[model samples]
Target chain A: MAVLTDEQTMLRDMAREWAGNESPVGAWRKVRDAGEAAGFDAAAFGTMAEMGWTGIIIPEAQGGSDFGWLSLGLVIEELGKTMTASPLAASAAAASAILLGGSDEQKMAYLPRIASGELVATLAVDEGPRHDPANTAASVSDGKLSGTKAFVAEGDSAGLFVVAATDGLYLVEAGEGVSVSRRHAVDFRSHAEIVFDGARAAKLAEGGTGLLDAVLDRAAVLASAEMLGMAGQSFDTTLAYLKQRVQFGQVLATFQALQHRMATLFSEIELMRSAVEAGLTAIDRGGDTRAAASLAKAKANEVGHLMSRELIQLHGGIGMTDEYDAGFYLKRMRVLEQMWGNAAYHRERFARLSGF
Target chain B: MATLADPVAETAVDAFRDEVRAFLAANFPPSLKGKDNAMSAVEGPTAETPEQAAWRKAMGAKGWGVPTWPSAYGGGGLSREQAKILAEEMARAGAWNPIGGMGVMMFGPTLLEYGSEEQKLEHIPAIARGEVRWCQGYSEPNAGSDLANLQCFAEDRGDHYVVNGQKTWTSGGQWADKCFCLVRTDKNQKQGGITFLLIDMDSPGVEVKPIRMISGMSPFCETFFTDVKVPKTNRVGEEGQGWTIGKRLLQHERTNLSGGGSAFRMAGPSLADMAKHYAGVDGEGRIADAELRARIAKWEMDWRVFQLTALRVLAESKAVGGVSEVSSILKTVGTKLGQERAELIIEIRGMQGLGWEGEGYGEDELHSVRAWLFGKATTIYGGSTEVQNNVIAKRILGMLDHQ
Candidate 1:
């Protein structure tokens, strides 16, 4: 973990407490069981707003704490542990996009509402299932945008979309030409495939050529933070299980084989955390973060997948059952792995960024 | 646009910086710049060039070589921040600390913590000044990972103990002036029976034979003791407290082996760059072999993640005591990465990597092959990977012990 300031420590502790009390995995289970198209509970996000989590990254003038990306990452990591189903990550990414490129008018119109949790916004980059931002087919013409964005998280809930076009980024409200249809992913989160037949496009032209990539990089770090949480909780669950569950008249943790496996997972998870925190730090530093973002998400995907798999296998038969929460973590892990970029995607991207 | 010194000008830091500069300018010979004696790490006091000898002597006298140790014991007694400044300045000047060995790295710190006032008065000054060399007398043939199972007996004879036992893999044993030994004080109990004893290496019946390793280097020795007399006054702690003190010392050793800030770490082009030199590049400026390219990329990413974790650990541990649990994790990860890096280097070399002899092989190529072989001992030595996992599990993770 980073050497967090007193403020960051308090914020992280507050988020952990709130997530544990208000929205645990059971809360996500309820949302998933209810089959809501919006994915997360509205009341949960309202509570988030009340606690000022929805505004950590937004500037003070825009009704937020402006604590920065590391602060936001710390909050999101806590949310991730409890499997808190919210558009917090998505909305934050969208907020970052606007903050980076949106005009003062856009900031006044959207930042406060987003901070208050009254409005949810999301970044739509890939037009296909995979997260390929550079291969965008969406185009803007005469203040109108037309194209498709596949598997957009929080799409059903987002009132605004920071759409990535072939040229750059443009903001489009979720109405009229913007049609959101259900895209059922394995995690059962709110995902949508939206077809925009010339939606009213407001260009984020001030962000210049690299705006879309910058926005996606921020989103990747956000996703990595969540994965860090899930991976950590998975390890904690397994560690607790190993201590209690006995076989052959000895606790499972006593076995050298199991102990070594747990140790390996523990170290790998630490690396994953380091990568995520470094990425968040890089984003906060406001320097070139392309390589950092790729490495972060790549490690999250790599370790998250391994850890989720190990979480199940370590728990034995009970882990395979639906009643157990291990499978939920694996499900979420698979989805998040594919979110910003999978291991291979980011590895390739990292190689390109590193010029290897 | 500003120099690194701009922010701290005219402060106490600047004064100290000036003092350091003055000290270096007067004492540090320009001819010795950028050249660290490679043998310093693996061997003891080989015949040094006049400049090297002068450099070591000057550093020892000034005590800046062991900068963070107490000044009462002839050390610089600098704060952590000051030590960091000294490191930066030294690196900026292409200077490396010439005063280091097991005495400075592990034993000196442990002795300061656990040794008596008289013992500290007697021993620490020499260690701080890099005047005497020390070797560990802990591991034995019967006790590798199960170090407590050691059976080197130290029979009590009122004023002194007659030590009659052997300690293997005693690193730099032949070169050391003294040995910090773990001797069995009681034959009845395992851990409770151990005693920490200091023995003069030149004493009668003390023998050290350097063992040739697969790396073709004789860096370690098979140390034997045959009725070697060690005085009761030389005992570090209580008779039965060796296990506690020895374990604390191992923590220090493990931290050093963890490779966080060890000097003499490889420096040059990265493995990817080296691979490009060996294997041709494609049209897109990528490694020619896609599979090899991906593997190199993966290694770089993993290595990066490890380095970041090291940084985080350093930051989190500020204003705190020793990060004991973290050291095990560092040792396990760092050693594996070291081994992995050697393999990647070999992979980059292809058939050229296997060169071991005089003709046709570059000095670097031959050295790397030996380093690759020597790297295997790293994981096995400073608490093997399996033992480290046990440390993580039982100690750090609070898992149940074997009943």
Candidate 2:
């Protein structure tokens, strides 16, 4: 119910300007054609970082802007509009988890670098096929980490890693024992299979009292925010395409059928936005972040997946083709579909949280 | 997402709730107890006796016929939140609405917004007391979807307007005491040059013929107006501005129509309840097939979204001064949800859903099937979901006309 204020407006506008200038559809096409990932643009990430986006939600003490979650939600949404392949979303979310759950020294050590865009971080939570942090196959053994983490976004590119082990969070830097193998994913994001073969890791937060649970909860909220942005972009892009793409005696936009479809999709986007906002509000008000995060992630996963599929299906064959930018949004949507767990995972999480 | 934990409006709302509860408890007839009037698919006011009349008179005297409108205009003059409390209280008491039909649902609000002072004074009191029932005069043989292309003509005369038109799908037109109508005042213009006029049902050369449906219930009618005279004063708004007025009224109509199925709660066994009731013992307690249950779940989810979207609309209307373009989106989504939910209920009923003769199945399940079949109107009426998306695209999304 609290609408975006001035600071939120400014952050959103900045992201919009940056996206329009640096990660335009043409720029995305250029990157894609040059064999770069759809959302894996380092130059664009640098620009976003320069615009003070990476640290928008980080504290001022961490050499970052102290904007709220709503501001960060806006920035993520704008970046999602272009499906710009940058670890900006992952880095911000991972950094938020650390800043919120990490100790004071942990925050001081990692946050400043994250804020300055000197190091990028991605959470390696899914050690197995299932995206469950609690059911971790990857364990910490005597100050060393083993087992593999799949679908780690920017894992190959990231300099710092926030690994959620059985014990707690371990700060695993890019080193000899840690090998990052790039995983060719559907969304064309720079995903990786990070293998830790007895990798020496530093435990940032030990004596875990649901620290991994807390971090995963935060990750869900953060991923939901990013997905909120993705769905918004998908809705906008599809709407624009519907208007411009002419077919059979009238513009495809003229079809009432498609209009109705777009309207339904728009409603889904708003629902996702509301859920994400609710999670942010809960986090802001010091409410139960776990429940809110589950709700947000569940709502986002449902709407995000449905909207993305419909966005493509409604556009017909043209929506399926790679010539148009619709595919980019869909790609980002697929990546988000798996990021921080899918809809089913969140539904079960929500069920558990709600004591269903 | 603003915490309503200690919402500022709570005190007044709580007081209003108490007042409504006390009033309903005292006045609610024993005959109406456990009635669950809202659950009825074919909505007819349930209170039929003099006691019921007295109750209606008492509530209507306080302008509670429609609670949210201004008291001067024969409404309760309550804030929306207060009105919502009254509704919740009434709903809890199993009380039926004192008034019904197109007048209360669509026309009353329209008149309040666009009616002249004379029109308000003439119409509002009668409407509040349920003294006059109103019907819509918009759709024609060829003008169901493209309503603006209506051929209904009203020629200006010295002292009045002479209307000559045919309106079809006029629900409850056979029973209406009056009709608020749209007439093509100028043939030269398509959507423009139209006027909204009110005419007495008993006016000379006016006729209403009920159109019998497959359900054997004639909820709608075909009205033929041949030189039916309407007073100049009966016009709701300025000349050539009726199109705009009609459009706004339709927005209100969509709001009313979009909320159509929200009140549907069957007295005996909802589809889900019946599924639970008739399950396991029959075959592992799964009242319906897995596919059917899945479909039901999907529909239930759709219904939840529809309700949430409706609540969002109401919340926005309260937050902003007026309705947003998202109302159209709600209308579109809610109607589909209703249709889908009803269809699933019918599908879940299996062969019992097939009703041909009198009371073959239980009243609830049979009524559900009938309701499902009748729910086809969801897509067709108030403004097809098609037209709604056009509004969303052009007005809300700013995509259609951007080029």
lDDT of 2 by residue, A230-311 (tens): 7877777677777777877677776766766777687677656656777776666654677667667877888988888888
TM-score of 1: 0.96
RMSD of each: 2.7, 5.1
Give every collision pair in model 1. none
lDDT of 1 by residue, B216-259 (tens): 88889999999898889999999999999999998788778775
Locate the minimum summed-lDDT window of 10 residues in model 2 chain A. A347-356
In order, the TM-score of chain B in each prediction is 0.94, 0.86
Off by over 4 Å in 1: B1-12, B43-45, B262-266, B319-327
Per-residue alpha-carbon lDDT of candidate 2 for residues B75-145, written as tens digits (9 for 90 to 100): 78987667777887777777877665667777888888888788888898788877787888989998887
DockQ of each: 0.74, 0.23
Docking quality level of the chain pair in candidate 2: acceptable
